[model samples]
Target: MLTTDSNKATEIRQAAAKHHGLPLLPRPTDDERDPLRWPRSLKLAALIATAFVNFTANFAGAGLSVASPVLQAQFHKTPNQVNSLLTFNFLLLGVGNLFWVPLGVKFGKRASLLISTLILFAVLVWTAKETAFAGLLAARCLSGFASAAGESIVPSIVTDIFFLHEHAAMMSWYTILVSSATAIGPLVASFIVQYSRGGWVDYVWVCAALAGANTVAIYFLYPESNFNRPKEPLHRVSVTGEDADKVQVVKTETISRHRVSVVSKSWFSIWTSVFTINREINILEVALRPLKMLLRPSVLLATFIYGTSLASQIILIFAFPSLLLAPPYLFSSSQVGLMQIAAIIGFSIGCFAGGYIADIITAVVIRRQTGNVYPEQRLVALIPGCLVAPAGCILIAFACSDKLHWVAIAFGFGMVSFGTIYAPNIAITYVVECYPRVVAECLVAINVFKNLVAFLFLYTAVDWVASSGWTQVYMIMFMLVSLSMLLAIPFYFFGPKWRGQVDISNVSEE
Candidate 1:
């Protein structure tokens, strides 16, 4: 038993080692089953699997962009109608979060992921075989629905397995895969369509193959990361003696066994466990919780910022074919695909700036604050991103309007990509840190907003650019991106107070 003495408890707490100058948050328990206590290798493997699924999801959604010309000619459709292939997919990707995340909450992240991966594999195969425009559209929409698991559940998994100190770094890794996949997918697809005899359909087949492999990998690599951990103190301290000199401190927390059992279960049993739904969870409430979360200002602001940034990327992707293929540039499909290299370069830098550098800055802030940790402390990382992303938009606008060098346009795309990674990484991470108890719902809300914004912008991208011209449209984008990134400043100062005012007890209650 632990003593209830306040002075001794305080002394023992002071004696404990600190993690980046702060105590471990949502403290891990003595229970070996707690995900936070899992082996480093296991934790990393799970994260890689989750991130790969995210990569595959985005790759499938955007890879077809490079093939737009081929697709338009094949389907005998207008540009806007053709763009619907990607736009509708984006819409369902957001809407699907509403469905899959609730199911993940009820069934298990691992289980939900497995089911979604299987569905994604089937849809990819269907997409490869579809000959008609409507068939391809339906197939792509289903793929988006299946892909939502990557967007919504991944952040929750990161929270489950990683400490607060590790969140930014881990999320950066996930975001790199996601953002890079979007950029790289087109690069790969452009080459495939340009060189392959099957043209655009070859890209769909490749995605299907990857999705099939991903399903098998998920089965083996991703176990149930969702552990219902009990709330406990950071550590329990007991003073064994009354004498100041003679007192002994006993640390009570111990791992009796490793979290993972070595005994192997039958494949069927594992499958059944993954599919089993938890009766205790309220399905309806889980589904509606994300919608309810939108009422919170922090949630809305974070989602809006993230949504607009993502939409900017979508619009750029939609416009690329039209601008590069038809303009004075008259670039080949392969050349257009290579343009993504610039975005990838930006993603690489942003990943380092947003993830590792942000983590370092956050630790410094915590130390300076005398070990006090706040969610807003992480916002400092967004400063560079806020400035860079909007500038990138302006550069792109000018490059297009003046018919500047292709390198200038590529550089602008790179800048916007940098901002996309930098700002949203902080925004989404901040929301999760603020509402640790309701991470899934918060992520669902962000994804819904992100996809909705992307869907609307992308659906109208062709006509919007055609009617307004690139300069006017991108200038408007510059304003929207700048305003959204700037909003973080106010939130950084007053977010804590505002967060306190919101009531999430009802939604988070078991």
Candidate 2:
């Protein structure tokens, strides 16, 4: 038995050193243990709780549209002015990541998650109660700021917890929640406002209810997932010796023993972890890291891909309600809400398929390229999605402009939703893998770029479509999206060369 255990540990150490250029395992502090080492059920519970919080945050952001008309009537605000609610909220959502992500880096993820969720809950309550338009807008700004945690911080959380092979599928869940929340928020909110006497207030209250539930769930379920392992390899080795040619061998029995011991901590001790900060964190360095990463070719490529993909979705969010309310279709708010269900279906398919497809395609590419997976292999997965997304945009433009059947319009919307979904899941997984040392910073850059691009679309989309006609407006979007995705071609081929140029000195694991 002792000899077998020695051989297993030797194989793991050799594999880790050969493949990862790092240690088999560090002398872990209480918080420095890998989250993957946790029991399967505990890790799964953590994922579900985190995803629910993500859903609640996005649900709040996307539901603002359903409340716009009632808000306009009550406050005598113009449609354009009401739209500013989304505009400013999105702006804050992007910019807020600069601060929130750094704080997550400086403090533990559980602390950051708890603090943000609590703030989101309070803002939702204020949004529910506020009668003044200005007050409501102010509340949403804070809400967006707080809710930035879901997009910017959660992906890093996934990276911290899951292994490289699991990232694509795990990230797909985050992408799905974000897209589904955007579509479903309006579907649920439109009906509530249309039927309930409480109107917009009722919708806000629903968001608040979900927010409260998410807060409690997170408090009970989410533990600190950040684990800073040593750069140097461990000195210990198995008696059997090194097998550098083989893949890493993880010993399940050994990990299970560690899980049993570590996870047995009391609930009170876990709760107090919200106040724990990463002692190695340098706040100033954390604030500046994303900006530096923005200059990297791989990072910039992800920005364009994710940013353009997000812009297409934002345009649809604003366009659907405006267009359906006017002209031949003359749909009610509830009907318009139902129209978004098409998008939900598309997003679900995209989210579910993107993960597996990316993983499979990447594996194939890896086998062909070097018999070892490279981060750039993930780019191949985006090719199909890139082509499909632009085509979907063109379809939407033609369908809406030609006054085609509602089914035609719905199909176009779904195609666009489905196509756009692929870009983020692939891009995020690729980039995170590429810069595991600075996952938070890379995500902050991506969010900032994506949100800024989406903000531009939000402000210009309605007017552009109205003035240029849907064909012209969508054609322009298609062109931009195509160009962005095309950029991936060069990266797919030459990404390693570009990545080699990056200055690792700027990267801090803390």
Candidate 3:
């Protein structure tokens, strides 16, 4: 065995094993197979593939919102009935993760992702071809289920491959893809509905084509990121000369013994293994883990903060077609589609502002505190999002009620879109950092609550605005969203302490 002076070893570890003065979390080992130790090129490729699938998933789900008018005319249905397609889809998008995430935990993320992508492709095609309204609704529901893996598993893959310090920047890219897809989906669908002879069918087929391509890409390009390395014991080092009488034990965050591979498994064998379930993992417990995580104060707070931000965007998507398609606006499908450009710009700016900029600010805060880093430090970034999003909602209400220029409504949409990316990026990064071990389940809980919140608002938003008037309904939403975002203040101060109160060791370790 190799040996060094205890003090010298500690110094070396401290100097070499830190990022921005913070210790490397879930510390990496020497094993080549460890994702932390993977090459930069490989890591980037995985991230790209993951982001692509995420975009395709959200694109498929939200793109249809732009086609609601066409669908209503084709099926002779009311706007509320047309809106149900998205409402029920959002509901299952959340609840479906309860099923898919457990499979990811028991099998592997690659398997779960591949399986879901295939299902998504099939459902998208079914949606394109379905003639009846009820049939299309069924296809939409299945598409939501297929999309769940894309939302929940991508975060786990991010955590598996990247260290804590890299999460904010990386998650920013992920969130930008997701948010941009939501905006761009409608943009693309609008053009298709206006220009393409196939109309709404072409939009669904576009998503289907992307999903099919992503499935093939995943089969070859994506590697299984799930690796369960056993924990290592403390490294004990001896002293020399005058300090020989004293010994010091240095604790590591996590360490693993390296093993040489005598045989390399075939790609076919590796692919086949993804479906093999590890019997040691309790399927039932894994399935129910998200529900238990929902009870944690940190998780609950993060969910509401993230959920409300997302709901703001969903409300805009649901309302835009009706608002812009009628009255002084009388916008064409293509013009309405152009509206998403504002949201895309907002998402792009928010990604950099909240993601890369936040990481830099976090480093500054860590340095000021002499290398101490807390998850709460990230919460500071949510402030701008909280203030801006509700303000945007208020702007939209006024713009619509007063019949202002369409540019005002677009600008308001941009502001709301900014909040969707900015606040949720921090909220998600914070919660995942707080519960790093249970990332898969934590994300499941977050997505479930987020989607449920969107579903409840969307299910009632059309009727509410019809009954209560746009000004009153949106004012209430603005207040609710503002109150939800404000909760971050208390969480920033007490979140760390409250996180300690919840024990996830049993579920995470298992």
Candidate 4:
């Protein structure tokens, strides 16, 4: 086993000999240590794989929008049929989280990340060879399922590796990879479809490269975080009657469960001890945790923000190519792709700003409260974006029909992209902080619900946004944003109350 720099080799030694009767295992030698240093190497490791995952997943999902017209002609299908591709992508993407999240916990997180990337590699290869539209849709759906594990577990990995002081910052950086990739997705897809002689083959190539690079980097550079390792074993001692008052010598039983997994394998499991409702829980209760988690307040708020904010993107995916290609713009698929660059740029800035800003705001709140920080404090940063998102949405709505400088419309859409990621990032950080015990489950449910919202909107968003016009749609976005802020207001004030409830409810493990 490679233990990074923690003298993990020493810990494994102590653990094996601690009367646990676990088999001794070989450890990595000096040559295997990570030689790369710093915010530079660490940032590269954290951002690069995440970016690759985002790039691949986004291409698989939204790349087709640029080629919708051709796909329709080739398949002899309707607009709605083309729309199913997006709907199908979102449908399984939401639910896929449930299966992968538990696996992430059961296996080590490192293994889960590697497993998903490998699956993605195979799926994309399959995608490139398919001619039938139905086959392509199925490939995309499977890709979404494979991608969900990466999306659900990434925040957890960030939280685990980085210190509490750095959690929001790192989380935000990762969020940028997501939000920017999303905003930029169709733009890249459009151009690829326009230029490639093989038509959509280019999309597959892009994902293939991204996934391949990420797989290589993760296998080499990514370390198993300290939080992921089993807990320190409990030390047991014995006493002599003559020295009853004095400490005794005895064997220690570590919290590290006996490698009930003595034999290494692709998949592994062990009995996990959990406390639920102050009752000692078996593996069954913990397994069932994701089912009930959707009902929690933090989760619902996360879902609302996630679902509502992402609906805006789905609208663009369905509408943008049609809007730009039909009008006075009359651009090629490549030009339409270039149009998305504005939104991508805006979203990139917004994602990075939101990540660091949310962290800073939460830090300030934490310090003011004397180390007793409320997770809702992160929500405070989202309120402004909530208000701004609608305004931007309305602008895009009006510009879409009015047919302004075209640049104006792009700017409006860009603002909407920025506004969307701003709050969602904070919402993500806050929700996880609020429910750290079920981080993977909470994210899976949030993504699942959010994906449902996207699925619903993708199938119908074109009609909804166009029927309502940019103006009416924007107004509706405004209302939702207001609702989010109003909902969040309580969080700022009563966040401490909920945190207290959670703290009070948690019994000491001893």
lDDT of each: 0.79, 0.76, 0.78, 0.64
Model 2: per-residue Cα lDDT over 343-432, one tens digit each: 888898898778876776664454344344567878888876667788889898889998899999888888888866788889889898
Candidate 1 residues 1-510, lDDT tens each?
A: 356566554554454323343345566666665677766776788889878888998899999988887788888888888888898888898899998988888888888888899999999988888888888899999999999898979988999988877788889888888888889899999999999999888888889888888788778876676777664322223334344333333332322111223233334543445664677789888888888788766787877777777777767877898899876999999998999999999999988888877876776665554445678888877875578888888999889888899999999999999877877887778888877778899899989987887777888888998899989988988899989877878888987787764445354421
Clashing pairs in 4: 233-254, 233-255, 234-254, 394-474, 397-470
**Candidates 1 and 2 compared by TM-score, better number:** 1
Q: lDDT per residue, candidate 4, 140-244, as tens digits?
A: 889888877767778776655443445566776666666666656677777678777877677777777777777766666555431322222222222223332
Q: lDDT score, residue 437, model 3?
A: 71
Q: In model 1, which regions exceed 4 Å deviation? A: 1-19, 231-273, 501-510
Scored by lDDT, model 4 comes in at: 0.64
Which ranges of candidate 4 are over 4 A from the true structure? 1-47, 226-287, 466-468, 499-510
Please provide TM-scores, in order, for all candidate models, with all chains considered together. Answer: 0.88, 0.87, 0.87, 0.78
Query: Between candidates 3 and 4, which one is better according to lDDT?
Result: 3
lDDT of 4 at 203: 75
lDDT of 3 at 192: 90
Rank candidates by TM-score, best first. Answer: 1, 3, 2, 4
Which one is best on TM-score?
1
Angstrom error at residue 72, model 4: 0.9
lDDT pick, better of 1 and 2: 1
- The C-alpha local distance difference test score for the whole of candidate 2 amounts to 0.76
Error of 4 at 331 (Å): 2.1
- The Cα error of candidate 1 at residue 451, in Å, is 0.9
What lDDT, from 0 to 1, does candidate 1 have?
A: 0.79
